[model samples]
Target: MSHPDTLIAEDLLLLLMDDEKGRLSASSQAQPLLGGALLVQLALDGAVEVEETNSRWRPAKVEARQVAGTDPDPLLAGAWETVAQKPRSAQDLVSRLGKGVREQLQDRLVAKGMLERRQTRVLGLFPSTVWPAADRQHEQQVRQRLQDCLVAGAAPDARTAALVALLAAVDQAHKVVDRGALSTGEVKRRAKAISEGAWAAKAVRDAVAASQAAITAAVMASTAATVSAGS
Candidate 1:
């Protein structure tokens, strides 16, 4: 496969630093102090040229160093394991592993060439070649099922299940898109619409709330620990 044109952004580049098990992660955010839309547009257009900019955005490059330990998140490790085996849909992976882990895994994997993403229609039809034969077949099956379920306007439970299944297929296709494994954009386009369903919206909301709670607890615990130590 061809290397994806780098999309340089003013935002820091999230590099995937993998451990021995191929469980990927990023140690620190590589803040892009320069290049913004110019970089993104170049990447979107598949241009691989690297244009140098001012040093303001460039942080001192840290020498190559080894990580002595594994990532704190086991879900992240597991997600990499799944993606390494084959391209997967972000939607499907998220259904199994929560949205946070899924999104993190996608970011890491996409950086590491293990995953790709694209938007697709609700019916899951996209013209992308990144999919392996097996994954494409799976996508086709899920697409047909979703179409049938929607056409019949099945009971609420059945409709929900069908939609969920369809999302899973789309998630796998997204991995392909992120990796530049597919050339077509249809799957990505369709999946974007499907992802906005009622169930998905609720799931995203719950995940966000839980994440906020976790961060609050961590901050509180850290403050308590510091106070006790100082006293």
Candidate 2:
């Protein structure tokens, strides 16, 4: 199977980022989403498997197992190595696989000319880094794919389906898409449908479900931590 030059996670980062502000729209939730994207991509590439326990006593798990003729990408290879090291629940693997992914992916995109890295100081004191879009050609294509699927009622391919799932998982589908005459609710509903649609294999579906669950858990955990700190 042929894969896009950019990984799903890269595309997702682009989608979630505000091109002008150089900040992610849902910055706090990006980690789980990126990790989830990696898991689904690995499943799509036949580099990993999401095994279902189908029992109340046990949980779903992911195993690293590459197809005979396939060679995983370097970043993916590293994540695959982590998975190969042990069988873990998807939620456990989400944050683990996502660690350092954002920085690495940002640097990769910067080197590829898809984004520009800028240094700024907050209050003229604190140094900060921001990535703004340098090249929008690739991002436009990704948005177009989402447009076709969510607005035009087109059936999405595996990658597009996975992206829809990730965006919907974080409730960012309507925020990212133009929606034209469509209401935000309609766009989100369409996004939800595509996420749950029959466009991928069982393993891929399981991976998507795991990603959604992991994202929810991560968001709740972050919220709880913030509350605790404030209290």
Backbone atom clashes (below 3 Å) for every candidate:
30, 0
How well does model 2 score by local distance difference test? 0.86
Each model's C-alpha lDDT?
Answer: 0.30, 0.86
lDDT (Cα, 0-100) at 102 in candidate 1: 29
In lDDT terms, which candidate is top?
A: 2
Model 2 lDDT, residue 213, Cα? 86
Give the poorly placed runs of model 1, Cα more than 4 Å off: 1-200
lDDT of 1 by residue, 1-231 (tens): 111222211111221222222222221111111111121222222221222334754421111112233332343234334434543322222233332332443454455453445443444775432211212333344445444333333322322332332222223323322323333354444443343334333433222222223323333555588789999
Model 1 TM = 0.20
lDDT of 1: 0.30
- TM-score of each model, paired residue for residue: 0.20, 0.95
